[model samples]
Target: MLHRCNEQLQQFSHVNKKALDQYVNFTEQREELQKRQAELDAGDEKIKELISVLDQRKDESIERTFKGVARHFREVFSELVQGGHGHLVMMKKKDGEPADDDDEDGPREADMEGRVEKYIGVSFTGQGETQSMKQLSGGQKTVVALTLIFAIQRCDPAPFYLFDEIDAALDPQYRTAVGNMIRRLADTSNTQFITTTFRPELVKVADQIYGVTHKNRVSRVNVVSRDDALDFIEHDQSYNAE
Candidate 1:
Protein backbone atom coordinates (compact mmCIF):
# COMPACT_ATOMS: atom_id res chain seq x y z
CA MET A 1 0.00 0.00 0.00
CA LEU A 2 2.83 2.45 0.74
CA HIS A 3 4.49 1.73 -2.61
CA ARG A 4 1.22 2.30 -4.54
CA CYS A 5 0.75 5.64 -2.74
CA ASN A 6 4.32 6.75 -3.67
CA GLU A 7 3.67 5.87 -7.38
CA GLN A 8 0.45 7.93 -7.42
CA LEU A 9 2.21 10.97 -5.90
CA GLN A 10 4.99 10.78 -8.52
CA GLN A 11 2.48 10.62 -11.40
CA PHE A 12 0.59 13.64 -10.07
CA SER A 13 3.83 15.61 -9.68
CA HIS A 14 4.86 14.83 -13.26
CA VAL A 15 1.42 15.91 -14.64
CA ASN A 16 1.49 19.15 -12.65
CA LYS A 17 4.99 19.97 -13.93
CA LYS A 18 3.93 19.32 -17.54
CA ALA A 19 0.85 21.58 -17.18
CA LEU A 20 2.94 24.36 -15.61
CA ASP A 21 5.46 24.26 -18.49
CA GLN A 22 2.62 24.44 -21.03
CA TYR A 23 1.12 27.47 -19.26
CA VAL A 24 4.46 29.29 -19.25
CA ASN A 25 5.03 28.57 -22.99
CA PHE A 26 1.52 29.78 -23.89
CA THR A 27 2.07 32.99 -21.92
CA GLU A 28 5.31 33.72 -23.77
CA GLN A 29 3.62 33.10 -27.16
CA ARG A 30 0.78 35.44 -26.27
CA GLU A 31 3.24 38.18 -25.33
CA GLU A 32 5.13 37.75 -28.60
CA LEU A 33 1.92 37.95 -30.61
CA GLN A 34 0.96 41.16 -28.80
CA LYS A 35 4.34 42.68 -29.61
CA ARG A 36 4.00 41.77 -33.29
CA GLN A 37 0.50 43.25 -33.38
CA ALA A 38 1.80 46.55 -31.97
CA GLU A 39 4.53 46.71 -34.60
CA LEU A 40 1.99 46.04 -37.33
CA ASP A 41 -0.27 48.77 -35.99
CA ALA A 42 2.59 51.28 -36.05
CA GLY A 43 3.58 50.29 -39.57
CA ASP A 44 0.00 50.70 -40.75
CA GLU A 45 -0.11 54.23 -39.36
CA LYS A 46 3.16 55.16 -41.09
CA ILE A 47 1.86 53.84 -44.40
CA LYS A 48 -1.29 55.89 -44.05
CA GLU A 49 0.74 59.02 -43.41
CA LEU A 50 2.86 58.41 -46.51
CA ILE A 51 -0.24 57.94 -48.59
CA SER A 52 -1.68 61.23 -47.31
CA VAL A 53 1.52 63.13 -48.21
CA LEU A 54 1.56 61.64 -51.71
CA ASP A 55 -2.04 62.68 -52.28
CA GLN A 56 -1.27 66.24 -51.24
CA ARG A 57 1.70 66.41 -53.60
CA LYS A 58 -0.44 65.09 -56.41
CA ASP A 59 -3.01 67.83 -55.89
CA GLU A 60 -0.34 70.53 -55.78
CA SER A 61 1.27 69.29 -58.98
CA ILE A 62 -2.06 69.26 -60.76
CA GLU A 63 -2.87 72.79 -59.66
CA ARG A 64 0.50 74.12 -60.77
CA THR A 65 0.27 72.42 -64.16
CA PHE A 66 -3.22 73.71 -64.76
CA LYS A 67 -2.17 77.26 -63.98
CA GLY A 68 0.83 77.08 -66.26
CA VAL A 69 -1.22 75.75 -69.13
CA ALA A 70 -3.83 78.42 -68.64
CA ARG A 71 -1.25 81.19 -68.66
CA HIS A 72 0.38 79.84 -71.79
CA PHE A 73 -2.97 79.56 -73.49
CA ARG A 74 -3.69 83.21 -72.88
CA GLU A 75 -0.32 84.30 -74.18
CA VAL A 76 -0.52 82.12 -77.28
CA PHE A 77 -4.03 83.33 -78.06
CA SER A 78 -2.94 86.94 -77.75
CA GLU A 79 -0.04 86.23 -80.05
CA LEU A 80 -2.20 84.52 -82.63
CA VAL A 81 -4.94 87.13 -82.57
CA GLN A 82 -3.88 90.69 -81.99
CA GLY A 83 -6.17 92.70 -79.69
CA GLY A 84 -7.70 89.44 -78.40
CA HIS A 85 -7.94 87.85 -75.00
CA GLY A 86 -8.40 84.24 -73.97
CA HIS A 87 -8.65 82.34 -70.68
CA LEU A 88 -9.44 78.87 -69.41
CA VAL A 89 -11.81 78.10 -66.55
CA MET A 90 -11.91 74.96 -64.48
CA MET A 91 -15.40 73.56 -64.00
CA LYS A 92 -16.26 71.07 -61.29
CA LYS A 93 -18.78 68.32 -61.83
CA LYS A 94 -22.18 69.16 -60.46
CA ASP A 95 -23.01 65.63 -59.39
CA GLY A 96 -19.51 64.34 -58.60
CA GLU A 97 -19.84 61.39 -60.96
CA PRO A 98 -21.75 59.98 -63.88
CA ALA A 99 -25.33 58.98 -63.24
CA ASP A 100 -25.95 55.52 -61.90
CA ASP A 101 -29.18 53.71 -60.93
CA ASP A 102 -27.79 52.98 -57.49
CA ASP A 103 -27.46 56.68 -56.66
CA GLU A 104 -30.87 58.20 -55.99
CA ASP A 105 -30.05 61.52 -54.31
CA GLY A 106 -26.91 62.24 -56.31
CA PRO A 107 -23.42 62.18 -54.81
CA ARG A 108 -22.71 63.34 -51.29
CA GLU A 109 -20.17 66.06 -50.40
CA ALA A 110 -17.53 63.50 -49.52
CA ASP A 111 -18.05 61.72 -52.82
CA MET A 112 -17.71 65.03 -54.68
CA GLU A 113 -14.47 65.79 -52.87
CA GLY A 114 -13.07 62.45 -53.92
CA ARG A 115 -13.75 63.09 -57.63
CA VAL A 116 -10.89 64.46 -59.73
CA GLU A 117 -12.60 64.77 -63.08
CA LYS A 118 -13.00 68.34 -64.27
CA TYR A 119 -13.98 70.34 -67.36
CA ILE A 120 -12.11 73.18 -69.04
CA GLY A 121 -14.22 75.99 -70.38
CA VAL A 122 -12.73 78.36 -72.90
CA SER A 123 -13.52 82.06 -72.95
CA PHE A 124 -12.41 84.04 -75.99
CA THR A 125 -12.60 87.72 -76.66
CA GLY A 126 -11.97 89.07 -80.14
CA GLN A 127 -13.01 92.16 -82.07
CA GLY A 128 -14.42 93.75 -78.89
CA GLU A 129 -16.68 90.82 -78.13
CA THR A 130 -16.43 88.04 -75.55
CA GLN A 131 -17.84 84.68 -76.58
CA SER A 132 -17.94 81.15 -75.31
CA MET A 133 -16.43 78.37 -77.37
CA LYS A 134 -19.86 77.21 -78.52
CA GLN A 135 -20.76 80.71 -79.68
CA LEU A 136 -17.58 81.41 -81.61
CA SER A 137 -17.39 81.26 -85.39
CA GLY A 138 -15.78 78.21 -86.97
CA GLY A 139 -12.63 80.13 -87.84
CA GLN A 140 -12.53 81.73 -84.40
CA LYS A 141 -13.00 78.40 -82.77
CA THR A 142 -10.18 76.93 -84.77
CA VAL A 143 -7.87 79.72 -83.66
CA VAL A 144 -8.85 79.21 -80.03
CA ALA A 145 -8.30 75.47 -80.27
CA LEU A 146 -4.93 75.87 -81.86
CA THR A 147 -4.00 78.50 -79.30
CA LEU A 148 -4.82 76.09 -76.52
CA ILE A 149 -2.66 73.42 -78.14
CA PHE A 150 0.22 75.86 -78.50
CA ALA A 151 -0.20 76.86 -74.88
CA ILE A 152 0.07 73.26 -73.75
CA GLN A 153 3.10 72.80 -75.96
CA ARG A 154 4.76 75.71 -74.24
CA CYS A 155 4.20 73.96 -70.94
CA ASP A 156 5.38 70.57 -72.18
CA PRO A 157 7.02 70.58 -75.57
CA ALA A 158 7.16 67.43 -77.69
CA PRO A 159 10.02 66.51 -79.99
CA PHE A 160 7.94 67.09 -83.07
CA TYR A 161 4.47 68.15 -84.26
CA LEU A 162 2.42 67.27 -87.33
CA PHE A 163 -0.34 69.64 -88.30
CA ASP A 164 -2.66 69.12 -91.29
CA GLU A 165 -4.24 72.28 -92.67
CA ILE A 166 -4.01 73.97 -89.27
CA ASP A 167 -4.73 77.33 -90.82
CA ALA A 168 -7.37 76.13 -93.24
CA ALA A 169 -10.20 77.88 -91.39
CA LEU A 170 -8.25 80.97 -90.31
CA ASP A 171 -8.43 84.40 -91.88
CA PRO A 172 -5.43 85.59 -93.82
CA GLN A 173 -4.16 87.75 -90.96
CA TYR A 174 -4.50 84.95 -88.42
CA ARG A 175 -2.73 82.59 -90.79
CA THR A 176 0.17 85.00 -91.11
CA ALA A 177 0.41 85.28 -87.31
CA VAL A 178 0.33 81.52 -86.87
CA GLY A 179 2.94 81.00 -89.54
CA ASN A 180 5.23 83.50 -87.89
CA MET A 181 4.69 81.81 -84.55
CA ILE A 182 5.66 78.45 -86.03
CA ARG A 183 8.72 79.99 -87.65
CA ARG A 184 9.87 81.56 -84.36
CA LEU A 185 9.31 78.33 -82.49
CA ALA A 186 11.33 76.36 -85.02
CA ASP A 187 14.21 78.83 -84.96
CA THR A 188 14.33 78.95 -81.16
CA SER A 189 13.75 75.32 -80.18
CA ASN A 190 14.84 71.82 -81.16
CA THR A 191 11.26 70.88 -81.89
CA GLN A 192 10.31 70.18 -85.51
CA PHE A 193 7.15 71.04 -87.37
CA ILE A 194 5.74 69.01 -90.28
CA THR A 195 2.67 70.78 -91.56
CA THR A 196 0.57 70.55 -94.71
CA THR A 197 -0.73 73.98 -95.61
CA PHE A 198 -2.12 75.46 -98.79
CA ARG A 199 -1.18 78.99 -97.78
CA PRO A 200 2.10 80.57 -98.83
CA GLU A 201 2.61 82.04 -95.37
CA LEU A 202 3.78 78.68 -94.03
CA VAL A 203 5.54 77.60 -97.20
CA LYS A 204 7.76 80.67 -97.23
CA VAL A 205 9.12 79.75 -93.78
CA ALA A 206 9.78 76.08 -94.62
CA ASP A 207 13.18 74.54 -94.00
CA GLN A 208 12.34 71.84 -96.55
CA ILE A 209 9.36 71.41 -98.81
CA TYR A 210 7.65 68.30 -100.14
CA GLY A 211 4.95 68.18 -102.76
CA VAL A 212 2.34 65.41 -102.75
CA THR A 213 0.74 64.74 -106.11
CA HIS A 214 -2.10 62.28 -106.68
CA LYS A 215 -2.19 60.78 -110.16
CA ASN A 216 -4.65 58.04 -111.16
CA ARG A 217 -5.54 57.54 -107.45
CA VAL A 218 -1.87 57.01 -106.65
CA SER A 219 -0.16 59.59 -104.47
CA ARG A 220 3.51 60.46 -104.70
CA VAL A 221 5.44 62.52 -102.16
CA ASN A 222 8.60 64.09 -103.50
CA VAL A 223 10.97 66.72 -102.21
CA VAL A 224 10.61 70.00 -104.08
CA SER A 225 12.03 73.50 -103.95
CA ARG A 226 10.29 76.09 -101.80
CA ASP A 227 9.31 78.04 -104.92
CA ASP A 228 7.99 74.91 -106.61
CA ALA A 229 5.93 74.02 -103.57
CA LEU A 230 4.48 77.51 -103.43
CA ASP A 231 3.67 77.42 -107.16
CA PHE A 232 1.97 74.08 -106.81
CA ILE A 233 -0.15 75.31 -103.89
CA GLU A 234 -1.14 78.42 -105.85
CA HIS A 235 -2.07 76.36 -108.91
CA ASP A 236 -4.09 74.01 -106.77
CA GLN A 237 -5.90 76.92 -105.13
CA SER A 238 -6.76 78.40 -108.50
CA TYR A 239 -7.98 75.06 -109.75
CA ASN A 240 -10.19 74.64 -106.73
CA ALA A 241 -11.57 78.15 -107.19
CA GLU A 242 -12.40 77.37 -110.80
Candidate 2:
Protein backbone atom coordinates (compact mmCIF):
# COMPACT_ATOMS: atom_id res chain seq x y z
CA MET A 1 0.00 0.00 0.00
CA LEU A 2 2.82 2.53 0.77
CA HIS A 3 4.49 1.86 -2.61
CA ARG A 4 1.19 2.49 -4.53
CA CYS A 5 0.58 5.76 -2.63
CA ASN A 6 4.09 7.03 -3.49
CA GLU A 7 3.58 6.35 -7.20
CA GLN A 8 0.19 8.20 -7.26
CA LEU A 9 1.71 11.20 -5.45
CA GLN A 10 4.49 11.52 -8.14
CA GLN A 11 1.94 11.45 -10.95
CA PHE A 12 -0.17 14.14 -9.20
CA SER A 13 2.92 16.40 -8.84
CA HIS A 14 3.60 16.46 -12.66
CA VAL A 15 -0.08 17.10 -13.46
CA ASN A 16 -0.22 20.04 -11.00
CA LYS A 17 2.81 21.76 -12.69
CA LYS A 18 1.20 21.68 -16.16
CA ALA A 19 -2.15 22.98 -14.84
CA LEU A 20 -0.41 25.76 -12.89
CA ASP A 21 1.49 26.93 -16.00
CA GLN A 22 -1.73 27.08 -18.03
CA TYR A 23 -3.49 29.07 -15.26
CA VAL A 24 -0.61 31.56 -15.04
CA ASN A 25 -0.65 32.13 -18.83
CA PHE A 26 -4.42 32.71 -18.78
CA THR A 27 -4.12 35.22 -15.93
CA GLU A 28 -1.41 37.20 -17.76
CA GLN A 29 -3.41 37.32 -20.99
CA ARG A 30 -6.55 38.44 -19.15
CA GLU A 31 -4.66 41.21 -17.37
CA GLU A 32 -3.20 42.49 -20.67
CA LEU A 33 -6.61 42.47 -22.34
CA GLN A 34 -8.09 44.44 -19.44
CA LYS A 35 -5.34 47.05 -19.66
CA ARG A 36 -5.95 47.51 -23.38
CA GLN A 37 -9.67 47.89 -22.78
CA ALA A 38 -8.99 50.57 -20.17
CA GLU A 39 -6.83 52.49 -22.58
CA LEU A 40 -9.53 52.45 -25.24
CA ASP A 41 -12.12 53.63 -22.74
CA ALA A 42 -9.92 56.56 -21.76
CA GLY A 43 -9.50 57.69 -25.40
CA ASP A 44 -13.21 57.39 -26.18
CA GLU A 45 -14.15 60.59 -24.33
CA LYS A 46 -11.55 62.66 -26.14
CA ILE A 47 -12.71 61.38 -29.53
CA LYS A 48 -16.29 62.29 -28.69
CA GLU A 49 -15.26 65.78 -27.53
CA LEU A 50 -13.33 66.34 -30.74
CA ILE A 51 -16.36 65.38 -32.77
CA SER A 52 -18.52 67.79 -30.81
CA VAL A 53 -16.14 70.71 -31.33
CA LEU A 54 -15.88 70.03 -35.06
CA ASP A 55 -19.62 69.93 -35.33
CA GLN A 56 -19.91 73.27 -33.56
CA ARG A 57 -17.35 74.82 -35.91
CA LYS A 58 -19.33 73.55 -38.89
CA ASP A 59 -22.48 75.19 -37.59
CA GLU A 60 -20.63 78.47 -37.02
CA SER A 61 -19.35 78.44 -40.60
CA ILE A 62 -22.81 77.95 -41.99
CA GLU A 63 -24.18 80.69 -39.80
CA ARG A 64 -21.56 83.17 -40.91
CA THR A 65 -22.20 82.46 -44.55
CA PHE A 66 -25.91 82.79 -44.05
CA LYS A 67 -25.53 86.13 -42.30
CA GLY A 68 -23.30 87.42 -45.06
CA VAL A 69 -25.77 86.49 -47.74
CA ALA A 70 -28.65 87.93 -45.79
CA ARG A 71 -26.94 91.25 -45.28
CA HIS A 72 -26.13 91.55 -48.96
CA PHE A 73 -29.66 90.65 -49.86
CA ARG A 74 -31.09 93.37 -47.64
CA GLU A 75 -28.79 95.98 -49.09
CA VAL A 76 -29.65 94.99 -52.64
CA PHE A 77 -33.33 94.85 -51.88
CA SER A 78 -33.22 98.34 -50.44
CA GLU A 79 -31.32 99.59 -53.47
CA LEU A 80 -33.88 98.02 -55.78
CA VAL A 81 -36.81 99.17 -53.68
CA GLN A 82 -38.07 102.21 -51.86
CA GLY A 83 -39.09 100.65 -48.55
CA GLY A 84 -39.03 97.40 -46.47
CA HIS A 85 -36.40 94.63 -46.34
CA GLY A 86 -35.72 90.92 -46.76
CA HIS A 87 -34.37 88.03 -44.72
CA LEU A 88 -32.83 84.63 -45.15
CA VAL A 89 -34.84 82.92 -42.46
CA MET A 90 -33.33 79.95 -40.71
CA MET A 91 -35.65 77.16 -39.58
CA LYS A 92 -34.54 74.64 -36.98
CA LYS A 93 -35.79 71.44 -35.48
CA LYS A 94 -37.62 72.52 -32.39
CA ASP A 95 -38.19 69.04 -30.99
CA GLY A 96 -35.78 66.36 -29.93
CA GLU A 97 -34.80 64.13 -32.84
CA PRO A 98 -35.49 60.43 -32.66
CA ALA A 99 -32.23 58.51 -32.34
CA ASP A 100 -33.18 55.24 -33.98
CA ASP A 101 -35.49 53.72 -36.56
CA ASP A 102 -37.93 52.80 -33.80
CA ASP A 103 -37.91 56.43 -32.55
CA GLU A 104 -35.58 55.69 -29.72
CA ASP A 105 -33.18 58.39 -28.52
CA GLY A 106 -30.09 58.61 -30.66
CA PRO A 107 -26.60 58.92 -29.24
CA ARG A 108 -26.28 62.32 -27.54
CA GLU A 109 -22.74 62.63 -28.89
CA ALA A 110 -23.78 62.18 -32.54
CA ASP A 111 -26.66 64.66 -32.44
CA MET A 112 -24.78 67.64 -33.84
CA GLU A 113 -25.54 66.99 -37.50
CA GLY A 114 -27.61 69.71 -39.15
CA ARG A 115 -31.18 69.91 -37.99
CA VAL A 116 -31.77 73.28 -39.56
CA GLU A 117 -32.58 74.79 -42.94
CA LYS A 118 -32.82 78.28 -44.42
CA TYR A 119 -35.38 79.97 -46.66
CA ILE A 120 -35.80 83.36 -48.35
CA GLY A 121 -38.52 85.82 -47.34
CA VAL A 122 -39.31 89.47 -47.95
CA SER A 123 -41.55 92.35 -46.91
CA PHE A 124 -42.84 95.34 -48.89
CA THR A 125 -44.01 98.28 -46.83
CA GLY A 126 -44.69 100.01 -50.11
CA GLN A 127 -47.60 97.65 -50.49
CA GLY A 128 -48.81 98.51 -46.96
CA GLU A 129 -48.19 94.91 -45.87
CA THR A 130 -45.47 92.44 -44.91
CA GLN A 131 -45.55 88.74 -45.74
CA SER A 132 -43.93 85.75 -47.43
CA MET A 133 -43.72 85.10 -51.16
CA LYS A 134 -47.33 83.89 -51.25
CA GLN A 135 -48.56 87.32 -50.19
CA LEU A 136 -46.24 89.54 -52.19
CA SER A 137 -47.25 91.33 -55.39
CA GLY A 138 -45.71 90.38 -58.73
CA GLY A 139 -43.28 93.29 -58.72
CA GLN A 140 -42.39 92.66 -55.09
CA LYS A 141 -41.73 89.02 -55.74
CA THR A 142 -39.62 89.79 -58.80
CA VAL A 143 -37.48 92.27 -56.89
CA VAL A 144 -37.04 89.82 -54.02
CA ALA A 145 -36.04 86.99 -56.32
CA LEU A 146 -33.61 89.16 -58.22
CA THR A 147 -32.05 90.53 -55.04
CA LEU A 148 -31.56 87.01 -53.73
CA ILE A 149 -29.77 85.98 -56.91
CA PHE A 150 -27.60 89.04 -56.73
CA ALA A 151 -26.79 88.41 -53.06
CA ILE A 152 -25.72 84.83 -53.68
CA GLN A 153 -23.60 85.92 -56.62
CA ARG A 154 -22.05 88.73 -54.63
CA CYS A 155 -21.02 86.24 -51.97
CA ASP A 156 -19.72 83.71 -54.49
CA PRO A 157 -19.56 85.33 -57.88
CA ALA A 158 -19.70 83.41 -61.13
CA PRO A 159 -17.72 84.25 -64.23
CA PHE A 160 -20.70 85.97 -65.84
CA TYR A 161 -24.45 86.40 -65.50
CA LEU A 162 -27.42 86.22 -67.88
CA PHE A 163 -30.69 87.97 -67.07
CA ASP A 164 -33.92 87.82 -69.08
CA GLU A 165 -36.23 90.80 -68.63
CA ILE A 166 -35.56 90.93 -64.89
CA ASP A 167 -36.79 94.50 -64.68
CA ALA A 168 -40.00 94.06 -66.63
CA ALA A 169 -42.20 94.03 -63.55
CA LEU A 170 -40.67 97.05 -61.86
CA ASP A 171 -41.70 100.68 -62.34
CA PRO A 172 -39.53 103.12 -64.26
CA GLN A 173 -37.68 104.29 -61.14
CA TYR A 174 -37.01 100.78 -59.91
CA ARG A 175 -36.06 99.62 -63.40
CA THR A 176 -33.52 102.38 -63.61
CA ALA A 177 -32.19 101.41 -60.20
CA VAL A 178 -31.79 97.82 -61.31
CA GLY A 179 -30.05 98.94 -64.48
CA ASN A 180 -27.70 101.12 -62.42
CA MET A 181 -27.10 98.25 -60.06
CA ILE A 182 -26.07 96.08 -62.99
CA ARG A 183 -23.75 98.76 -64.28
CA ARG A 184 -22.16 99.17 -60.84
CA LEU A 185 -21.75 95.43 -60.46
CA ALA A 186 -20.13 95.25 -63.89
CA ASP A 187 -17.72 98.01 -62.94
CA THR A 188 -16.88 96.42 -59.60
CA SER A 189 -16.13 92.94 -60.91
CA ASN A 190 -14.87 91.49 -64.16
CA THR A 191 -18.16 89.64 -64.52
CA GLN A 192 -20.26 90.58 -67.53
CA PHE A 193 -24.04 90.84 -67.71
CA ILE A 194 -26.19 90.08 -70.72
CA THR A 195 -29.70 91.28 -70.01
CA THR A 196 -32.81 91.56 -72.16
CA THR A 197 -35.17 94.40 -71.47
CA PHE A 198 -37.76 96.78 -72.97
CA ARG A 199 -37.14 99.58 -70.50
CA PRO A 200 -35.29 102.59 -71.92
CA GLU A 201 -33.72 103.00 -68.49
CA LEU A 202 -31.92 99.69 -68.91
CA VAL A 203 -30.98 100.51 -72.51
CA LYS A 204 -29.46 103.77 -71.40
CA VAL A 205 -27.16 101.90 -69.01
CA ALA A 206 -26.07 99.39 -71.67
CA ASP A 207 -22.76 99.70 -73.50
CA GLN A 208 -24.55 98.42 -76.62
CA ILE A 209 -28.19 97.85 -77.41
CA TYR A 210 -30.00 95.60 -79.89
CA GLY A 211 -33.53 95.94 -81.27
CA VAL A 212 -35.24 92.68 -82.14
CA THR A 213 -37.98 92.94 -84.73
CA HIS A 214 -39.83 90.44 -86.91
CA LYS A 215 -39.57 92.05 -90.30
CA ASN A 216 -40.99 90.03 -93.21
CA ARG A 217 -41.75 87.24 -90.70
CA VAL A 218 -38.03 86.88 -89.83
CA SER A 219 -36.21 87.86 -86.65
CA ARG A 220 -33.49 90.46 -87.01
CA VAL A 221 -31.15 92.14 -84.52
CA ASN A 222 -30.65 95.84 -85.15
CA VAL A 223 -27.95 97.89 -83.47
CA VAL A 224 -29.68 101.17 -82.66
CA SER A 225 -28.81 104.54 -81.21
CA ARG A 226 -29.93 105.33 -77.67
CA ASP A 227 -32.66 107.56 -79.11
CA ASP A 228 -33.85 104.80 -81.38
CA ALA A 229 -33.98 102.42 -78.45
CA LEU A 230 -36.20 104.95 -76.65
CA ASP A 231 -38.35 105.17 -79.76
CA PHE A 232 -38.83 101.41 -79.76
CA ILE A 233 -39.74 101.33 -76.07
CA GLU A 234 -42.15 104.29 -76.15
CA HIS A 235 -43.69 103.28 -79.46
CA ASP A 236 -44.00 99.57 -78.78
CA GLN A 237 -47.40 99.38 -80.54
CA SER A 238 -46.11 101.09 -83.67
CA TYR A 239 -42.81 99.24 -83.53
CA ASN A 240 -44.62 95.87 -83.39
CA ALA A 241 -47.35 96.96 -85.80
CA GLU A 242 -44.82 97.83 -88.49
RMSD of each: 8.4, 9.0
lDDT by residue (124-196, candidate 2, tens digit) is 3334343667776788788878888899889999988989988878877888888899999989988889989
What is the Cα-based TM-score of model 2? Answer: 0.62
Evaluated at residue 209, the lDDT of candidate 2 is 83
Task: List residue ranges in candidate 1 displaced over 4 A.
Answer: 1-41, 93-132, 216-218
**In model 2, what lDDT does residue 107 have?**
24
TM-score per prediction, in order, is 0.69, 0.62
List, residue by residue over 66-165, the lDDT tens digit for candidate 1: 6677778778988987887766654445633322222122222232133244433334555555566788788988898898888888989999999999
- Best model number under TM-score: 1
How badly does each model clash, as a count of residue pairs? 0, 1
Which pairs of residues have clashing backbones in candidate 2? 99-106
